[model samples]
Target: MQATRTEEKTAETHGGASSPQPQQRLRDKKVGDLIAGKKRLVEVPYTASLADTINTLVANRIMAVAVAAPPGQWIGAGGSMILESDKQTGAVRKHYIGMVTMLDVLAHIAGNDVAPAVEGGGGGGGELERKMQVPVSTIIGHCLESLSLWTLNYNTSILDCMEVFSKGIHRALVPVDGHLENVGGVELMESASSYHMVTQMDLIKFLKVHEAELRGILTRRVRELGGLTDIVFGVTDKTNVIDAIKCMNSASLHAVPIVESTDEIGDDHGQLVNGKDRKLVGTFSATDLRGCPISQLQSCLHMNIVDFLEKLLDTPQQEACGLRTSTREHITCQPESLLREVVDKAINSHVHRVWVVDGRGLLAGLVSLADIIRMMRVWMLSEPA
Candidate 1:
């Protein structure tokens, strides 16, 4: 009897572990599925000037473009990343090098090439010569097919789609054949803040209203708003990490607001720090949650209110995160917190921006470190007056 009982117990344990595998297998069964795809390639001429290329990058808001020889010459290569463009010839004197990111630009500006001029010349007069560039085709991985991922049909259930995204890709480029040669569809990652997925009719209406209002406000200051909050296209804190990410891609916003509840400042505790009061206990800025585990977020939601508030006290600033100004503390106010306070804080604490909040403690606007310098310039100009 004892021998029989042991065998049964072992079998139960084995069965339990095996159950999830079948589910995962079922979920992953459609590896052969295919969908629509599109080719979004940027090819830069070898002789193209760096200024023109950078201009293209700036205009298109794209990080990198393919670098190819002029016309039909695929055998030879020049560079991958194109940095400087010549004003006179309009030929881009790009680096015959590797990949380049916004970080490269920031590093060049902050490092030995400090005060590199952004205007004029290809590599002659400006700070353009210091940067490195490369050809896009050479660096585009080992396989052309690898550049894109196969996507499921649009009719696939959202849960199934979510499973694909959870497998760790921001978006998938669907192809017509089981091959990536023919591009067809785009399956956007699911986002927690996205109201589109919510079937509830009333919630959708509320989101539309809120979005319209936010858009109206954004129209006034797209360029002026430098921080991530300034460009957050989606808002939701109640969602799992996957949901928030999906909203980011769908909204095409650089920043996404992770709020407990969009209807009010705070209502849901799922993403909020404190579940007790209907207040913004904490905020999950994109920068704050980047590369963090979703499991940790649950604990963050349950943290003490004071600790949550304390997290906000530190500057969302970094030594070299991006071009957007970062602040050590939230300090923007009416008439602006005395210019002296702004200057002193920036210099002493190494902060790059000072956020202005209203009486309700909600973020109102911001002032950049550059803005402070500009103010000083204005002061110097007024000295003679």
Candidate 2:
């Protein structure tokens, strides 16, 4: 995406035919510039049912969507949909409540309160349907508060967005400047002029496009960069899918490593034995639930996570029908690997995080999109004189 205003301003400031340094251009780039080329925002009302919300996410092929307050509560009666501002006094009106993601849905389904109902055999399908009918607002309570929706002003700098994402905020909403429109007593966000969702992937893609200018930072090894940690959370290969989901939900993790361990001596928390030698076998993620039918998911919950993944990947039905499933093989990087390699693996594999391994192929830590962005922010701020 081109940064029209920022580019024009930069070109004007530097003499014609000469461009500003890449670092200066990136620092001056604003959230509005990044979002200017993005598609219109997708949103769901707070009162929308969980089933509707799930359908919307699948239909849009998006992992999350902004949840907004009901119509009249957030906007006034006008035939134009605009930013949350009063037409007369120009005061702000808070419209968006938060974001509801696929993880939230998985957490709700795998929560302690709902697990028993799901495991109870009699009329379980009906119960699952009932749970799906609950309003989307109910799902927000099960999500990590840190993952809640954040807003950024259009003029906010790209560096500021990197800071936020570095702190584990997955996505932020950028409200486009526009007028509020009401149609037949219902406020509607105009397709051409609505909020744009900025994600870590967007920033990563931007970095990739500008990688030529970032050779110095990209060539550095992950170990030398110092973001890698020894602490890693994962589950044993024998862990049940339901228990794995619970562990991830409680920890607010997008994905967890599945390790092979012979020692079963541990609390039945479905986690790997701490301080034991384990080999990275696979992974289970909240994104695995994408496009999964509720009926199919309920049945798979009781299966072993590794078995479930194998079935998901090797099932003839999926392969024959050409269905999209979370079939990505586990991706890993070493501490000695270049940062650019990690970034390329994440973007090319279309995965959120990459596992870090020692020379023995044992789990060490993980590098997420957030971690990469954090490193970039550090590099930008610590550029040598």
User: Whose lDDT is greatest here?
Assistant: 2
Q: Ten consecutive residues with minimal summed lDDT in candidate 2?
A: 179-188
For 296-328, candidate 1 gives per-residue lDDT tens digits of: 323333343334334434433222222222222
Clash pairs for candidate 2: 78-182, 79-181, 80-180, 80-181, 81-179, 81-180, 81-181, 82-178, 82-179, 82-180
**Tens digit per residue, CA lDDT, model 2, 1-385:** 3788788878788776447765646656777777768987898887899889987876776778877674455431122233455546665554665578877887887764343234446435565677789988767746684234455667667777788878777776666763332111112343223578888898889878877767888999999998675678888877888888888888787778888756555545475444224588887777666545665766777778877877777554444323334434668899999999999998886677888888898888888898899999889878653
- Evaluated at residue 35, the lDDT of candidate 2 is 76
Q: How accurate is candidate 2 locally (lDDT)?
A: 0.71
TM-score of each: 0.28, 0.79
Q: Assess each prediction's global lDDT (C-alpha) against the native.
A: 0.33, 0.71
List ranges where model 1 is wrong by over 4 Å. 1-234, 239-336, 343-353, 369-377, 380-385
Tell me the alpha-carbon RMSD of every candidate.
24.7, 7.5
Candidate 2: regions farther than 4 A off: 1-24, 71-94, 113-123, 178-193, 264-269, 272-277, 314-328
